[model samples]
Target chain A: MKFSPLLDELIRELQVLPGIGPKSAQRMAFFLLERERPRGQRLAKVLDRAMSEIGHCQHCRTFTEQDLCEICANPKRAAVRQLCVVETPADLAALEQTHLYSGRYFVLMGHLSPLDGIGPAELGLDRLAQRLDEEQLEELILATNPTIEGEATAFYIANLARERGVKVTRIAHGVPVGGELELVDGTTLSHSLSGRRPLE
Target chain B: MKFSPLLDELIRELQVLPGIGPKSAQRMAFFLLERERPRGQRLAKVLDRAMSEIGHCQHCRTFTEQDLCEICANPKRAAVRQLCVVETPADLAALEQTHLYSGRYFVLMGHLSPLDGIGPAELGLDRLAQRLDEEQLEELILATNPTIEGEATAFYIANLARERGVKVTRIAHGVPVGGELELVDGTTLSHSLSGRRPLE
Candidate 1:
């Protein structure tokens, strides 16, 4: 009933990847088996090592093999005393691309979702509080997404920062660059209006 | 500039999978590192095995770990003495799903394309010819795709079978069942008209 047992198992296992369905998985398997066996073997080795060896940075919780990530270990970044809290390492990467801020980051890994049982403790707020207390942070920048859950997580963290006399600020919400005014959502337009800044 | 050296290598190597670009590769790498490391490790092992172990069936040229695939090894399938020539193992699987063919198959793996330097030898036509010479085949069915290259391959193989005195036939081309006639293409419509059969 099956074509090849190993090929079938490979296809099934490949579906663990996001957005890859059975058809795509089959294509990938066939491509690897037919055209790129050596490359596929290399991928296997790297993928296995990445999965088994990579762990969270002790300081920032971003993925890293080392105890402290590069950003966390940098003394100059630490001297800035400006900590940007983001929901994931992907968000940290996005911010780093802009070259706008020279501060360190704390990755929460996920946002608060009570319905899904994700809460403050799950987001590592205790670890964040420890950083705030020990580092005497100048400011805590909230770069969580603008979703309802993201907003709730940001608000919760803001209260925690307030209790410790740490000033908290959120990334600005507005129309995205190159986006049309009419295409912008109502909530985003309202936030843009309320959070307006003076012209330079 | 990079997140982690190992993570970067993993993401780059993952791009060898078809349709996985930089963004999807990053997401896949992070998803494995974050949520599914155990499953990812298992996938790596299976993928490595599939890439390294799977080889073409000696008789049919279909993908299999063994020299003779399950279909080729079965005596009843060989007893049918019918051989279907297909462009790929995927096509064989598709035909099997219809449950209309109980015979064995020969997979070309790819159609002829002179521009790409693939010819009869690359397609293992010599191996196919050996089967024609030795098997005393009752019938040879051309089920290659309906493309120009598929047509040329079918024609070439038909001559080969004719010279060997094996009955040669082709799968028909027509409007697909359950498809709208108005939406059918001109070439397929013409083929349908020329290949028409009388109503039962």
Candidate 2:
């Protein structure tokens, strides 16, 4: 049987999500159909509602219901003077998994890519710089990926923080060549942290 | 900050989806967090709603909001006198994309794999056999994949159909080795249709 156009549209939207290629999208679409009507309606409603309600945390740019994310609102986290900078909220989450950094985070959303036309302004570099100054951050940890674009973004942010006399650091090389921090095993991540050297 | 236990639960659930390994699941979880609170609620609602509303078509295992799926409900489809059997609803969708098959479909939802505890009973073979006896099936197309399990399933189904004194045919070898029907290019699929030969 042919999928209804609405069903196809939903599948297409799901396909846009990373790793959800055509087949997976079709499976998910069919799975949704197999779900109870209330379940599908609830999911669709929440999808629309979350898209409308979930906004960035003003303090750290992480997703949160309130102006500040849980980390930014917590007094316990405020005690830590470190700030980990990442290209996306997902990256911040990866670092958070380590339990090594009790500090705050700044999600840049994207890296510097001249070819793709992504630049400092587009990535909210000014907002990040302002936060660095306003928060009186002790350490600005650049945890962008190790790719060329990521490295470029890291250096740019590092320079911005360095100019303000705030110490800047990058997550270490425990991440393999062409490796993404999101995929690295926990032990390797810890070793990378322990072996971190100052960015020259 | 570590995700709350509830968020962790949701992320784990999301991870169970195919191709959504740990990192991608984490990304989806965080992305949803920024955007999921209500969206998640909606998803749950939709899941419950759709599951309750949809069920297996009485004639075919394809999901349908109504008692009979669109295909089974349509009189025109019943006139085709052919039956296309697939490993799953996704495979049925691949066949639908070809726009060549006018017959109805019977989704097995899985291939035969004795090693994996999958057998005729698990794949609803009895229902298919009943349908073959009931309908004036001109052709039973074994449109399953070319994988070991898929082949086994096809052979098993074909033998059953032949024993019932019904004609049986397998999809052409136009599908690449180890390639899923969903991944086959449209041109190759159409070519495969025209090149189909009688199965021994």
Candidate 3:
């Protein structure tokens, strides 16, 4: 209450983001104002630039500041033969961190959940199909999360990809590192046990 | 890794804010890109505009987009005989929230911590003295936090104000509402007990 209008505006704007409550927003507003005025300015500039300039890549639906994102622009990106499908840009970042996936990425941005009113069109399935038709992809890896919605979306996309004669794969999932037997839920432990394979 | 340049830029800018670690920065980055792009843009715009346009109010030392902030610009506020001194604009907000302080404010935006090389000049105590001379303040309330640095800063300013024949008073220190005695640490409990008064 009765905060500087600039602080008020910044806090209000910050509150619009996910998980940032009023108190945290106010703390952030004060901290930013105290430490670096330019930092706040730069954030605002980036936001303005991003909102005004960035758009979805024509091919992969990933956000881009230019006509195509750097991934799509790279000639050596293995875009022609291999592709990794993910639910959002965050997943893409996670995959990229491994430095193992040299293939191109297709970000769905959301999963298909009819209950949430998200469908094939909303998840960009038609765009993926178009990309599949245009590119000579040998394989399509469904690297979505292991959640129910992620599974349903992966299955739907895999079915569509299979119809077009492309190979489909799902990432393996089970108990995570440092997981405890007593604490692990039944379904997940069962899945871990069932999905076990020879170590050799 | 392998994030778009724009994404990388936004994340870098976000990291400049205090207490925002890399993980929270990443979450904020994705949240901005996905759910609140428009709001993010607006926030960014305000940040940019405020940063580029705002400066300290000549009279109070608080940030303002113009020569004086709205509070400092108001005739009613300037007409008040009491002056509240605070460590930062946030402290001013806390007092303003109570709607109990009808006086004007003078924000220090810092505290005197000589160990960290901060002193009277760094905290703009000289400027505050000048403001006190300019305005015929009936009372000057020291609203700094009750930390060691805050206490030192308060006494230093209080002494200075007394030398100039201006009345100076520090805000109270006491146990907060809903606070339990067992939960409170020793030093705080001592301060609260010493500062306690007889019931009216």
By TM-score, who's the top model here?
Answer: 1
DockQ value of candidate 1:
0.84
Model 2, B47-164: lDDT tens per residue?
Answer: 5455455566678887655667778788999999999998876777778888998889998878888887878998899999999989989999998887778888899999989998
| Residue lDDT tens for model 3, B1-200 | 45678877877878776667777888887777777777787888877766676677787888766687777888998788899989987788788889898788888888998888889998888888888778888899999998988888899999878988899888877677899888988888898999889999
Model 3 / residue A185 / CA error / Å: 1.9
Count clashing residue pairs per candidate. 0, 34, 1
Q: Each candidate's fnat, in order?
A: 0.81, 0.20, 0.69
| Rank by DockQ (best first) | 1, 3, 2
- Which model is ahead, 1 or 3, in terms of DockQ? 1
Which residue pairs clash in candidate 1? none
Looking at the true structure's interface, with contacts defined as alpha carbon pairs within 8 Å between chains A and B, what fraction does model 3 recover? 0.69
- Give the alpha carbon lDDT tens digit for every residue of B1-200 in model 1: 56888888998999999999999999999888878989999999998888889999998999999889999999989999899999988899899999989999999999988899999999999999999999978999999999999999999999999999999999999999999989999999999999999999
lDDT per residue for candidate 3 within A140-172, as digits (tens), equals 999999899999999999998998999999887
DockQ of each: 0.84, 0.18, 0.61
Candidate 2 lDDT by residue in tens digits, A19-117: 567678777767656433444454454444454556677877766556777788889888788888888766777787777888888888778998878
Q: Model 1 segments beyond 4 Å from truth?
A: none
- C-alpha local distance difference test of each model: 0.93, 0.74, 0.82
